[model samples]
Target: MTIGATYLGDDRCDFSLWGPTLDQVTLEILTPEPQSHPLGQDDWGYWRTSLDNIPPGTRYQYRLNGDRLRPDPMSRFQPEGVHGPSAVVNQGDFSWQDEAWRGIPLEESIIYELHIGTFTAAGTFEAAISRLADLKALGITTIEIMPVAQFPGDRNWGYDGAYPFAVQNSYGGPDGLRSLVNAAHQAGLAVILDVVYNHFGPEGNYSRDFGPYFTDNYQTPWGGAINFDDAYSHGVRQFVIENALYWLREYHFDGLRLDAIHAIYDGGAKHILAELSDRLTQFNQTATYPRYLIAESDLNDVRIIRPRPDHGLGMDAQWSDDFHHSLHTLLTGEQQGYYEDFGSCQQLATAWRESFVYRWTYSPHRKRFHGSDTRDRPPSQFVICSQNHDQVGNRMLGERLSQLVSFDGLKLAAAATLLNPGIPLLFMGEEYGEDSPFLYFIDHQDADLVEAVRQGRKREFEAFHASGTPPDAASLETLKTSTLKWHKRDSGHHQILLNFYQYLIQRRNTNPAITTGDRQQIQTQYNNESRWFSVHQSQANHSIWAIFNFGETLIQSPPAPNQTWTKTLDSSESIWQGFGPTAPQTLKGSESIKIPPLTVVLYENS
Candidate 1:
């Protein structure tokens, strides 16, 4: 059933609310007129009422049990804050110009993830639309936006969303999001929304008052797991599934990025991920463009991406943190916390060729043998990134790669992520090395909740043993400090870094060897003691070799492959603001080459 207000033409509207346990429900129209009407309950505990002459934009609430008033659980728009009335929105009224838009293929996706509130100074969806062309020009084929669901206040990392169906009121509500999606599709960019289904925000969540939306059967890092398998789970399941479809069908999103699937506990015969994936598959049968479901799982489990027929979760793809961890530990030499399991050239090479560094191997962090072999899975099933929100913001100080690593190290990291076999995802400003940190921020109305969040952040960083107090997550200054500086991309070394990123992306797209996405044709080797790693990829008769030196001093490398090679890209070249073109331009058998410190060099068979 369509929960919340559904605007029918001719100034009529139908409102439905799922109040399984309530003895009574009264529709109270708070705007345009003051009126109340009793709703009829069906066999399944859903109350429904239709009103004539109730036009769109009518603000209303539900009087539950004839006493307490609550906003619609599936509110489409919250004109006021989450504590205020929900507005009736006519979703069909918006004009979309994306009839000819077909979504980008998963294999060809170069995603750029951004937080709308921080992407621009205006901090609105419409403001974000002005920068879509900039991303398209940067070779970004897809835009993965952080969650836009309604929260208590405007500032947040989006995980604290409370109303699953309502567009954020502070971010311009439903119409603002629709306009952004429409503009993005017209700009030849596929837009995917990041959704948090594991837990609702601490504040403004009123679903429990209506029904059993959460259960104590299982516990999550946040609190009780969602009631996916408990009593009345059928209704809960449908509510979540319909929300996923609503975004794809109503808003015309290309896909959804499931946030932290590892925390979404479900012990049912049909896992929720598999069920959601099956629904997406069914939707794709007749969809104008394919819709995808990408999962963010830390389990390192291939079953998440494995086919449903094969008894797997059937996610289209999953983020592979092994690649990021390996690259990060190697570049920064950080050996504490989770980074303990990484920091070797061998692991970095393994992640490049195998997609998972801990494939049935011992993990010191977990003190157990973890992960399964993904050799049977294609490389496109994984998404790799050098730096993401979690990696940067989770730190006590929220330092970005531009702040932690040297300029040469940044270039090497970019090349490794872009040229790897898996799909590449770029964080908001990493392409031009934005120095601002992506700190975790939130705006909650409750004073106790604010203190709890501030303390939670401090305790979470205990492992890092970082000095200095973390920026208050509830402060407006923290959000402002996290905003990206757009002008930085056009000046001095930052501009050069931008050029280097463009060149690497172009090579990854046009070059046959790098574009194949074939793991079988790739070979990786590294010397742990020498701190050198090499990836050799080939497709048909075309081949490319990338040699990386993570050491601080120049090192000598053996001869090139049997065939002669011509230099293509050297991160240490003067074009990229490097000191010199230290590596030789051409190489053949019986000739060793000198590699500069903290540099990456590429060669194509001539």
Candidate 2:
């Protein structure tokens, strides 16, 4: 079959797709009654046509060489199912108001990661936008939205998206997304979409029929790897690159969080990531704001965020899993799974000092020497979070850190994250300590696929059997339980946690030492036996010290009697609503201070 198209002044008004192996090629146009265009090429295998009148909203599907009709691989919009007619969408037609919105710098970003389906009661992009002002008021500079690409069902976490270009119809489709992003920009919050390029969903994947989109050479835990380095990979790469640009160019998304770069598996001269980053950079040249890319990688490789000029993939940042693990292990003391490798205060100290554990050290869990020092890199290149979707949702029943740690411990965790050097991120409902579990739930037409998901979850948690079996994936209760309790943000224990988070974020934003660049400028001292640690953040002219006590009993180690320091914040004081700032205390060169049980204290040098 021969592919043909005619260009009129840089715009293609007509295009023809041929499948010689089939019976006929019928052009089913949605406008002016669906019309059939007959095959005009040599042999019925060839189809050709050109029309200048067909404009946007002209939905069409080709009756392949004759019998089967399939949507175009390059379909801009699939309002119907993947098998239905493809609608013409003019991306340039949408009016955008973000001309003055320069993208938020990676360093200054305090991201709030959210899923639309659970973020609000309505579960639509427009509905999610209603909370933009609230999020901005909470000091969130960037909103890292979970994937919005079309998946198989009305409700999903969005990682199983098969229609890479189409926004989920249930979430108000393309127009809803455009409005959401525009509204977010208007509210002074940058939108960063989470994109999955690793694998497609189990159902409704038509890429295999149209071309070789998957490769058997490598496999991800979810499914087969995308064809990134194989023959015909150019088209596949173009498809993904175009999707990335589409979100930024058409929807005005400020950035993207690339889901699972370790599963990308590219063995080519120029990796797909390098090409994608280059294209994004080119687009940024003309765009009003710079676009950014963040990768989710388990490899702990700094190359993921390193620029292409330095022989790296050129992502703007990456989620620091080590930091999360260190914090989680310290707070919960649940040493199951990968957490078995981390628990001591030393682990947290290492994460604070070097930004990664197992950096050049042999990891018993992976059975290899993993990670490298990120000391030379800017702290902004790593996004740190005490609780994220994976950290919460992947649990046996999707329990958050709040479930295991005391209210004081929760405040301490907030202090550690907000005061750290990296970009701080918080999972949805985490700021208020919502008790709902973010379980894995999906609505697939294929019952076998549903059952497979259930079985997979059971096997994944075999090691953590004590955590209890995961909520049944097939139950509607699972999805319902994941929804955020918005009312909790203002009452009871939730209100206390919310206030603590706000105060920590406010302090982080206002203090130069807390938000500084160099990781080397930070110093950490911890006693492994005592289960206590002190983090001192110092710049050329100013310094702030934070002390955390994780033990069960209160301990007094005499205050420093020579050097004077003022208490800026503490988690133990009732007058401060558990957020304390004590009067100035004098300290000697080798003096120590009293630390309460499960409390954190911050001191600023006078």
Candidate achieving the largest TM-score: 1
lDDT of candidate 1 over 422-454, digit per residue (tens): 989999999999999999899999999999998
Candidate 2, residues 16-74, lDDT tens digits: the string is 54343344556776664666666454443345677756666667776654566777655
Model 1 regions lying over 4 Å from their true place: 589-591
- Where is model 2 poorest over a 10-residue stretch in terms of lDDT? 1-10
TM-score of each: 0.98, 0.92
Per-model C-alpha lDDT, please?
0.90, 0.79
Largest lDDT belongs to which candidate? 1
The alpha-carbon RMSD values of the candidates against the true structure, listed in the order shown, are: 1.3, 3.7
